[model samples]
Target: MDQHSDAYFISRVVLFNDQKAFEQLVKRYQKDVRSLLLRLTAGDHHKTDDLAQETFIRAYTYLRSFKAKARFSTWLLRIAYNIFLDSVKKEKRRKNTKLYPHQKSINPESGMDAQLDYTELMKILRPPERAAIHLAYISGMSHGDISKIMACPVGTVKSHISRGKNRIRTYLKLEL
Candidate 1:
């Protein structure tokens, strides 16, 4: 069976208080959720782990509310995305507050052997663009699926993907 059906089955079990079924669902999706969280947090281990846990916990708590109108993975990812964005906002606020001492000096020697990796540079895109590309390309999600996850129109998702791809091409100087 497809993953959605599997999730539906698990949800039914969990709704009836079946812990084994809940554990099975966790085992199935936890790795994927953690990987998505890791990418969203830019490899921040602590934040990613916390967000992943939160995603699952929230999913479990709301198990009875799932309507099966959307794929389970899509709903779970929406949770992860929201959590990631909240973390980003919190981090931005912390940075603005400057709770830590600021350093004024840049070490010239630090970059002496560090050449710019163009592929890595692509990751510097804004979060929306990065998420659009990652979901459409890496995760193989349809534009419609992304639209639901992002709470935007499908056309907007297409636009984001198009603009994001064009920008990446320009940044990498690659022919599209």
Candidate 2:
């Protein structure tokens, strides 16, 4: 589709609350959103799904407010990013409250596999750094795209990626 047609298509779904049009939008963007969420949540499939769902729900709810100053993907990703941060905050509060007594503790030395270690490393990074690295490395977003999604400058995005990568490398004991 041409750029204007695509914008009009998405705008119809937003302005008119067209379910089929929204579904088309979902089919077009769901994979990218889920993949971005998966990386941000450190490959936690369940949390990724939950966050992606929340992201889309939020986007649809706020669709009428969309200014169209940015691409739909960029706008959707900004929503997803907020959802991720909210989820993380909620999880932290839940942990602090000990709401679930039956949760299993993760042991670093249990030979769990590299995936677990990577997950643990992600947990250690600050949210912005983690988001930046995940967008750049895992989702393959350009620095400029990440900047738009993050509402930060491109140079800040690059700095986050560099610092996040360095921290992860140190955590994993990898030479850079």
Candidate 3:
């Protein structure tokens, strides 16, 4: 049934190579994966979609290797993170460019509302830090889950979240 559990679908896919079950799994988690990628790409819809598709492809190809030690969503996010990193490396190579220093340049004519959008805050955080905040807060993922997802130690994930939160707080001038 459609209400079957993730493990149920996973078993179906793993035991029988049931494409329909795998498709069901994809349908269930596609939005979560896409939204994460969208944030990572800074609202670049095309890049988010491409990376999400690649994540799914990698998941499908490597389904048999899934250990089930962590939640499937966490594993999926790990794949997505790796794919995004790979994409970033490829892009940098293609452009033969280095990361420029973050410059504080506000457009004089931009509306105040544009300035207030959280995406503006997100721009200040680097990829790993942003992913940490998004995963810990937006995705409701635990630090341990994020550690697995980002392939980092738990302490590193905590540091990223703390540093990211501090930066956002400073940007918004919030005392929490």
Note the Cα lDDT for every prediction shown.
0.69, 0.75, 0.82
- Candidate 2 is scored at a TM of 0.77
Which residue pairs collide in model 1, if any?
none
lDDT of 3 by residue, 1-176 (tens): 67899899988988998999999989999998998888788767898999999999899889889999989999999999999988887877888765422223344444433458766656767778878988888889888889999999999999988887777666666664
Q: Candidate 2 regions off by >4 Å?
A: 1-5, 97-121
Best candidate, lDDT: 3
Using TM-score as the measure, name the better of candidate 1 and candidate 3. 3
lDDT of 1 by residue, 108-159 (tens): 3333245655334444445566667778888899998998888899998888
Model 1 has an lDDT value of 0.69
Candidate 2: residue 7 lDDT (0-100): 71
lDDT of 2 by residue, 49-87 (tens): 988998888888888888888888889999998888777
Rank order by TM-score, top first?
A: 3, 2, 1
Give the per-residue Cα lDDT of candidate 2 at 119.
65
- The CA root-mean-square deviation of candidate 2, after full C-alpha superposition on the true structure, stands at 4.6
Q: What's the CA error at residue 97 for candidate 2, in Å?
A: 7.9
Clashing pairs in 3: none
Worst 10 residues of 1 by lDDT: 98-107
TM-score of each: 0.75, 0.77, 0.87
